[model samples]
Target: MRIRRVGAYALLLDCGEDEPDVPGRVEAWRAELARRRDRGELDAIEIVPAAATVLLDGVPDPAATARSIAGWTPRPAPVRGTAGVVEVPVTYDGADLPAVAEHWGASVPAVVERLAGTEFRVAFCGFAPGFPYLTGLPAALALPRLPTPRARVPAGSVALAGPYAGIYPTASPGGWLLVGRTGLVLFDVAADPPARLTPGTRVRLAPA
Candidate 1:
């Protein structure tokens, strides 16, 4: 792992070139980092896990922290406790649903079947608060983003763009190809956790 100082408060840990087929490696690293932080070895306020990068936030000195953490290797850790599987129901009747099905030479039902068949993990939350960027989408269902972003994508919009699937937590502009919609509220300010999803949670999409 190569660590680099990105800014005053951020240290970027580059987990080498991304392994296209091994998403578990990234997830393992994330779990390890979270463990280290909880043990008080690292004073990170936020840990952002991406496909090939793990960003540590709220470091006193980015350069010093990067140098120190670079020497330490991470161990594989299993997700435990409340951070387990979360099933969500989806309605496969989006505006772009037919177009995506046509692109893959499959029916809408076929596309939905493939999506609901696999279990995806919450890789990270970004783009919008509580909006989990889920990994493990089937390769056949991996579609490109829209040519133009929508003016407003409603909350609970289940979309797939590139290799990631995500549900919009709130109404926002987005470019992802919408395949379905969910009735469940993903983000709620009134709630304790606010966001329904978190990193390390396994999510299964089901037909509503």
Candidate 2:
């Protein structure tokens, strides 16, 4: 854990060498931070988890906060033995599907089959609220972001970038290559848990 001062806010960054043991580390930090915040030991205004780091905003003192976190050991990783695995139905008719297939030296059907064969876990939510960063995309399908970002990608648009896959939680500009679309609502403000794809939750994509 490292702490830095940014203007009026103190940012605490946890590499979580072990806490976020796997791809879903961000969610572990989220739940842990919530517990600390509830105890009033720390005041955390915002919790942002990315591919590699968890940013905690609004620590009164950076030096003291860093000392506290560094001295304390993180708890065990969350157990998902009882967590539900969410399966989403997708139509493999995306504009970039064929291009991606060609890039991988495989047919479109082959690409789809590979994608559906494995299960992925939600690693974190970023880029947009409720937008999940999923892990476990096969190495063969790993691809780069588009050279040109689309002005707007609709909600539930399934996209691939590098070794990760994601579903757009809301309409937003994105550069990931679209592979399919799902009818499932990933983010809904009115729902108890706005983002359906929480960390630790498993996701299996299937043909519509």
Candidate 3:
């Protein structure tokens, strides 16, 4: 892990070296930082995780804090139990369902079964509000983004790209391969937290 200064008051952790296990690393770092903060060893307002980096914002002494955690080894992300996993019921019929199945050299039922069997966790939120970039898909199953992004991917469209699975929270342009959809309301403007799928939220897709 390498720490780079971000402007005057923040630091960014470049986790490029741990690309394959970035999400787990992010989870581990966040937990460690929070633990340190609780013990009065660190101070930061936010511990945000992205595709490959974790941003430490509102830190009083960025350099010192960075140095403190520089030598610290990252632990594996904790596994959440079934009771804590959010189940999103999905209708396994999408425009790109056949394409995704073909890419895996598997039948539609096989693909659906595989996805339903795995657990996912929100790695970050980007592209749109409440749109979660989930991590769980193995490296062997990684796929490229759509060459021609859809003009407006409908809300709740369960999609995948690279090693992540995602859901379109709102109707918007997107490039991820659609494999299914859910009726779950991902976003609500008036809600306390607004987005249902925040970073670290565990999820499971169930066939409707």
TM-score of each: 0.84, 0.75, 0.92
Query: How would you encode candidate 3's per-residue C-alpha lDDT over 58-146 as one tens digit per residue?
Result: 99988888888887776666655698899999999988888888888899999999899989888889888888998888888888889
Q: Is candidate 1 or candidate 2 better by TM-score?
A: 1
Q: Assess the local accuracy of residue 95 in candidate 3 as a C-alpha lDDT between 0 and 100.
A: 83
- Write one digit per residue (lDDT tens) for candidate 2, span 75-186: 6555565257788899877889988898889899998998787688787788888988888875556798999899999888998998789999889999999999999888
User: Candidate 2 vs candidate 3: which has greater lDDT?
Assistant: 3
Please identify model 1 stretches exceeding 4 Å from their true place. 17-23, 60-68, 77-83
State model 3's lDDT: 0.86
TM-score of 1: 0.84
**lDDT score of model 1?**
0.83
Give the better candidate number (1 or 2) by lDDT. 1
Which pairs of residues collide in model 2? none
Q: List lDDT for all candidates, in order.
A: 0.83, 0.77, 0.86
Q: With candidate 2 superimposed using the best TM-score fit, by how many Å does residue 57's alpha carbon deviate from the native?
A: 2.6
Error of 2 at 67 (Å): 1.5
In model 2, what lDDT does residue 36 have? 78
